[model samples]
Target: MRHILSGIALAAGLLLGAGAPAVAQNPFEPVVYVNDAAVTRYEVQQRMRFMQVLGAAGTDAAGAEQALIDDRLRDFAARQAGIEVTDEGLQTGLEEFASRAGLGAAEFTAVLERAGIEQQAFRDFVASGVAWRAVVRQRIVPGISVSDAEIQQELTRRIETPVVTRVLLSELIIPAPPGQEDAAMARAREVAGSGPTEAQFAEAARRLSASGSAAAGGRLAWIDLENLPPSLRPVILSLSPGQTSQPLTVPGAVVLFHLRDTQGTLRPGAREQVLDYMTLRLASAAEAAALAARARSCDTLYAEAGGAAAAIQRQTVSQNAIPGLIATQLASLDDDEAAVVNYGGSADLVMLCSRQPALLAEAEAGVATTALADDGVEAAVPDEGALPSRDAVREEIFNRKATAAADAYLAELRADAVIRRP
Candidate 1:
């Protein structure tokens, strides 16, 4: 689900043209009923407009109706659980969410108002999310646990042992404008099947291809065959260098790929490590060092730093994708190990909560080389580091289990609700 706070900014852009005039709204007219609660037509219309503004796929009246129903269900469940978001808490949440777009809450709200969205409507949307989160934490966290054996099993499953094949491919995409799909497919078939030589293909691409690569004669960076759409993978693998694929009709376009080269390599999952970590930026090096010395685990840091506000950030990312300085600092640390680094007048306390080998997708040879270079890992020998700590694996497993439980619980709530549309 899209975060409510970020959705407001996106919806704001959509409301620019909607500020024409306000129609007198009848807030009491029921559009739908979930048990005893009534969802007003005014609210449904507002939600539908908001959906359109967010550019949601297939954002029609039907989808908007269903979404609003779900929101009502969530709101009902939250209220039953006594999950009320205080005014101060809601304000703080709005400010924190606005900070993601580098704007203050007041400034962000002003933009939304200019776009014709009511402040109360935005607040209601955010309140539902905050309340839902609280309910999930209260009802779901108690039953979740991760064992050492389970963590080991998860780590073992993530270590890939497959040999992947990569290809250097050139693409040509012919756009199928409304009512022109057949013509585009015919053109693609002709080009793919002996209609164009290599030089002719390049010329045709420069002239007729609709993709950005048309400017470069349809040349694409190396990509793993597996990375291509599932339907295209088998077709691509069957073609030899200098051969082209049959016209494959995709959404809005018909595509063709000219195989230029292929290579087989054993790429392990060692490069794919998900790191759950947190960074606390303190006012002084002395303060940071003191915190680091006292903190032994992620839980300890959370307890001590709860009130610091904006000075702490938590993230989960592939190890190779983290910033170079932090990645280097964390390279040798075990799970739950803390490191304090002083840079630019602030002291940063970094701790690792968990690490696990990641399930990696196939990539073209050139793409793999670039990724390895970025991670400061040699492509030939990617598995040069020590095994991830058990504690990190356990954390990952715990998170997965908790998420699954929460999803199931929400599904149950929706299924059990009495829903009627009139």
Candidate 2:
């Protein structure tokens, strides 16, 4: 399996246009160009090492196959959209990765180095992430869909099985001297409400709270309300934003909460969406210009061919069922229109056109079962449920359903794409 993974990696290396570089194989040169861009063996090795450390270090014959497929898809994407990764974007990515892993930039690099990964390779990995995500967003996400019933179902589930909403809070818990518990409690009392508003709580925490987060303000993060200390949950949730709770006795000292906000871990009913679209192909700059020209003569073509020249290829897709070319193009369109367009670009020219109304109706009908399910969520609502407004729920359902449909449509596209691997 590892060997298979390595083979796939090797194929990816080739697809990236990796080659040996140098005047006489200049030892100082660490990079080589694939296509019009430069990449280095150093970069690949570093990325591989990072992958290993990140536990993403696996490959098999199937892995190799997937890599080849991805490479071809990426090539098609690059040519279609003229996508390029930028240095600033790469830097931003590195910073984000480090932040997510709870490390400073320098510390993150140090860890990578300790793990035998090089900086350049890490950069390549970041760049690859940016490119791949772009492709997914561009070619896949737009055509995904969800239905109203899905949102309702999710909401209903949440109502039925509510998770305790807890505020995860941090305080500068100053330990009192053995004999000074009373004094500390007195001080805690003076500081509770008058000390900090939720927005100002961090500042107060830094200045007066006795804990580790003094430097970063009191950031409690996500805490489950049910799991909180018995005396803490009510105080935390009842206080409005910017309000502070009364000091309460705990094992060590007086504790209080500066309410930040409230969040619910509720899963409602099934959600759904309606998707509509049309697609066209423009393979080059000439083709884009010719679309207008062809449009002018469209009447003649319609008379001779029994349909517009554009009629040769058109797609109307639901949230769950979409054609691939249209799916890729839909990535650029709005939620309501992503699946209902013709999008093709000549090597340099790309155009996405809207779908016909009839096609949209066809898509809606096909995905109606899913859509109705999303819509029926509210009907299942219990009389005792204290839910948000119907409009808000409806909006959520619409967004979810549309997104789901677009996703299913894109999957179909990927499955049917005519990819040729080298």
Candidate 3:
């Protein structure tokens, strides 16, 4: 594997005899092919070098090849979804990535060039990452939702018992438009009674489900039993592998599930989830729509003054702490998704910035064993445990559900993908 060359200092170390070019490999040779796209030996070497520079020293050529293959799959999924990274967006992405190494894009490219890595290699890598995030946001996230009740139930479970069981499941979520509830239910009943093979269920999900995972065949990875909704736990637990759940009704949709498998393990669960969101009041529905169109994320969505724009406020709180109307509006949304709702005499654009699991975040930081008490008197030690936050538990449960769905979708993509060496 090649070494990652840094600045001018590393440049001299990488130079050949008399500061001439080093020995070359068959750079243009196709080492691997993912579907119609080719992964050249040049690209592999560049990736290996890039990762090494990025501190992934353990990644050899073989590891780089697999990573590039995954990128190919990601790029393909974005293409299938008609997601194109705009030049401006790509540049922003490049700048962001370059900033990680404490260098501007031009400087980073210069360093890579000195190491014989082409500028296009860096662009391709960043572009692929940007496109994949778009795929997840646009094609996978909207379908995964955590309910208020589920949040409370998760808190109760975490306090009384840590979740030990995780289940593999597939889903079919059919939208029941205001006037078409009966029709949607009828269709859902037919699907549920079909005794679908996993393949058949996947096909149905692709064709009939309204979820983002519809593109991935309604598949979901192993999710903890504690993370599931309290009401649905019994129904899901009742199923055996290959058994489909009866059509279950949720707000605005009728859904069914297929149990694939189950497992058990001890894992620390979430105690609370904090939400950071912003809302902009608008004078008219049309105004809200215009603003929503311009809004990509909280960072990008600016609050304007006067006319159509009215008031903007940012708040952070647990899910259950949000007002009923605002919470309901946020339920169907993913991070960065904006929903326009009638709040009194005007329209409100509610945008979610982030929803985080407090306990999980602490755990990752090596501080889950300690936290603030409810009275604000002092922090709790390991034996006393952290203060209970239903919101954090809610956040954890929701994140796991979302992650499982994404994994299932990606698995389908990998399975259908054609990988080869020629």
**Whole-model alpha-carbon lDDT for candidate 2:** 0.49
The lowest-lDDT stretch of 10 consecutive residues in candidate 2 is 1-10
**Taking the tens digit of each residue's C-alpha lDDT, what string does model 2 give over 1-422?**
21222222222223233333333543333343333333333444444445433423222223323433444445445456677778887778888776655666576676666545567656655665676557666766566555665655555554454444655565646454444544554455556635566556677677766777778787777776667765555556656656766555444554556666666554332232234433344455454445434432323323332333444443444445764554465556543222222234332122234333232233334522122236565444333224444466667766666556544644554675654322
Q: Which has the higher TM-score value, candidate number 1 or candidate number 3?
A: 1
Question: Where in model 3 is the C-alpha error above 4 Å?
Answer: 1-25, 101-104, 114-116, 149-399
Best TM-score goes to which candidate? 1
What TM-score, to 2 decimals, does candidate 2 have?
A: 0.31
Extract clashing residue pairs from model 3.
271-393, 272-391, 272-392, 272-393, 273-391, 273-392
Q: Give all candidate RMSDs, comma-separated.
A: 19.2, 24.4, 21.9
Instruction: Give the whole-model CA lDDT for all candidates, comma-separated.
Output: 0.69, 0.49, 0.73
Error of 3 at 378 (Å): 11
- Ranked candidates (TM-score, high to low): 1, 3, 2
**Alpha carbon lDDT of residue 204, candidate 2?**
67
Q: Report the C-alpha lDDT of model 1 over 122-155, residue by residue, as the tens digit.
A: 6776777787778878888888888766866665
* Greater-TM-score candidate between 1 and 2: 1
